[model samples]
Target: MIEVDEVCKSFTVRRRSGRLRRSRTLVGAVDRISFTVAAGEFVGYLGPNGAGKSTTIKMLTGILTPTSGRVRVSGLDPSRQRTALARRIGVVFGQRTTLWWDLPLRDSLTLVRHLYRVERSTHQARLAELTELLELGAFLDTPVRQLSLGQRMRGDLAAALVHDPELLVLDEPTIGLDVISKATVRAFLTRLNTERGTTILLTTHDLGDVERLCRRVMVIDHGRLAYDGSLPRLRAALDADRILIVDLARAAPPIEVDGARVVRTDGPRQWLAIPPSGNAAAVVAAVAARHEVEDISLREPGIEDLITRLYGGGVPADR
Candidate 1:
């Protein structure tokens, strides 16, 4: 669905050398990086601000031409075949809106229908489906400027999908949204990917978003590809441990379990730390067979924790 090969983007900034003299320096926002996304895949692209995440997205969307390397979406060069690429891809940037501020949601979508040259009947049907799927009925007639942050985001999602684009590039799709709103967006996206097979490339500061939506993640640091693989592999690479908390029927001696070590014992409850690469379900079943289990909960390594460890002492840049 997407291919980026040794893509690099840089910028030149000028600073006053003394009082009148100026010096120009070239800063590379994205170093040589390579990755590919297969169709129907939901991949997360993560990096701190100024780590070239935006630059990469812009290059993929044809908003900016890369200084070096190649970028393709759906087999077309995004920079050279922008018009064709646009028709196959939908983009949603949470901090910015593409909808007209003064227009009602319905009006904005009407414009989109015309802009995309969608058949009236097809547009109508898709609009209705999107409206219901995104729960935008109440605000269909409400102006974009009048809707709450959450409502506006739902509208954005619907707007992106109205054309039924094969690919979606979402930048912080859940930003500023409340818990319910976030869940709504996540569930909708999950269904879209699973049922419709829309390829999604999500970039978010919220690790929770990646945790819920992405199985494969690409981590970028200092404009370099730090990691690219499944979330489980990423965690395993961090050498962290998975914790299992078990509640027993009664307080007993520290339960010695194979493949796991007791890290904490609080009354009848005990905390066991299993190797990050270990089989958690097997450990759980083994312990349960020996003790009367009242409750069990597992805490996988937190995404944010792992990411922080991955980018030690790197301050988040405001790109």
Candidate 2:
């Protein structure tokens, strides 16, 4: 539902030089990045600070026009057809709320319905559904400014979806939320994609969000597309390793395993590094056979590690 071709965005900024002298320097935020998102697909877009993620999202959402190349959303040019595109897409910014701070949650949603010109009956039905799914009934009459962070976020999600847009673009939808709140948001998004068939483009710093909600992931670094594929392939491309944390019944030295090596230890707990090709079950069984294991857990390589690898040099040749 989204397409970008050879897109580039640049800006000119003046910097003070010696004394009263100044210099105008050109900066590239997004550099010839091209990608596509099919209808009903949930994709994760990731990057660190100043990585051009926000710039790309702004261009896609029509907030900013690119300096070069073309961008299309739902087959419409975002820059020229933004007014029409707004009707087909929903955007949620975690740091800010779209609702009116002084108005009750219901009233704020009502305003959105009116602004979108949705029929009264349709708006009621949609609001009812959102209220149930997002559990907004408790604070439906509460002022936005009075609600907790989680409540405000849930209310924002309802406001974004009140018009039934075809695509949803979320920027850190679960930021600063508690674990339960994050889970609720994730579950709702999963249903929105699977049952409602609403396409999703998620940009988040939380790897947990991507790991739980997205199947296909994209990594951008230094204003360029570094990788785009399934998470499994991403790990394989980087030869990423997983950590196995084993808790023994008593303190002991590092346990030796054929496919894994000890990377850290604390009392009876030990961390073992398993290669991408290593079988975690086999390693666990080996460790259990030799050591008195009380508990065990596995941790996949974090997104930060992959991003660090990519930024350390250039994109991986295999990717």
Candidate 3:
């Protein structure tokens, strides 16, 4: 449903030099980034701050034109066919609201319905469904400015989908939302993608969102494609060491455990990263034999650790 071919976006950024001096440099926000999302697939687009994730989304949504290369959504160039493309996609930017601040949520969504030129009957039906599903009835008559962050976010999501777009693009859809709100949004999106077959391209800093919603994940870093595949494959391919966390009865120098590298130490606690193929039992036995182990546990590496590895030094690129 979406395709990017060698897309690159560079901006002229000015840096302050010495007093009364300045320097202009071409900053590459996205560099030759290319990927494709299959129709009806839930995909996560992930990157740290300044990693070009937003730049790419902006281009796809026709908000920003790519400096180089091409972006196609639903086989049409987003930049050139923006108006037409608008009808095919629904976007929810967590930090921003499309609803009118001073207007009641109902009015705001009503305006969106008309803006999309939806039929009256269709609009009413969809609005009813959205209000019920998003549990917006309590605040449907409430002014958007008065709604809590979570309530506003819910309103925003409902506003985006009033027209029932075939594709949904969400950027940080759960940012600043409480646990219950996040869960509500996640559940809605899950139903949207599964039952409605709405193609989704989600960009988020929260790994929990990605882990929960996306089966296929794409990692972009330094404006380039770092990894693209199923989350499991990406985890396995990175082959990041499994960590063994041990707390000694007394504070001591980093545990001299064999077959594991001490990655971090906090007085009584030490974190040992063992190779994926390394035996956890053997490492635990070795550590217990040498020290007064008060507590020991193992934890599998998570997406955050993988992204850290990417930025620390790009993980060996795997598609």
Q: Candidate 3 — what's its lDDT? A: 0.91
Candidate that would win on TM-score: 2
Q: Write the per-residue lDDT of candidate 3 for residues 46-119, one digit (tens) a residue.
A: 98888998889999999889999989999889999999999889998988998999999999988998899999
How far off is model 2, as Cα RMSD? 2.1
**How many residue pairs clash in model 3?**
0
Model 2 accuracy (lDDT, Cα):
0.92
Misplaced by over 4 Å in model 2 are: 247-254, 266-269, 292-295, 313-319
Which wins on TM-score, candidate 1 or candidate 2?
A: 2
Q: Please list the residue runs of candidate 1 whose C-alpha ends up more than 4 Å from where it truly belongs after superposition.
A: 242-299, 312-319
lDDT by residue (tens digit), candidate 2, 1-319: 9999999999898999889999999999999999999999999999998989989998999999999999999999999999899888999999999899999999999999988889999999999999999999999999999999999999999999999999999988999999999999999999999999999999999989998999899998879999888887777778778999999999998899999999999999999999988999999999989888899999989988877876785655343
Clashing pairs for predicted structure model 3, backbone only: none
Error of 2 at 70 (Å): 0.2
Relative to the unseen true structure, what is the C-alpha lDDT of residue 71 in candidate 2, on a scale of 0 to 100?
A: 98
Residues 70-168, model 1: lDDT tens digits:
998989999899989888899999999999999999999999888888899999899888888889889999999999999999999888887899999
* TM-score, ranked from best to worst: 2, 3, 1
The TM-score obtained by model 3 is 0.90
Report every candidate's CA lDDT: 0.89, 0.92, 0.91
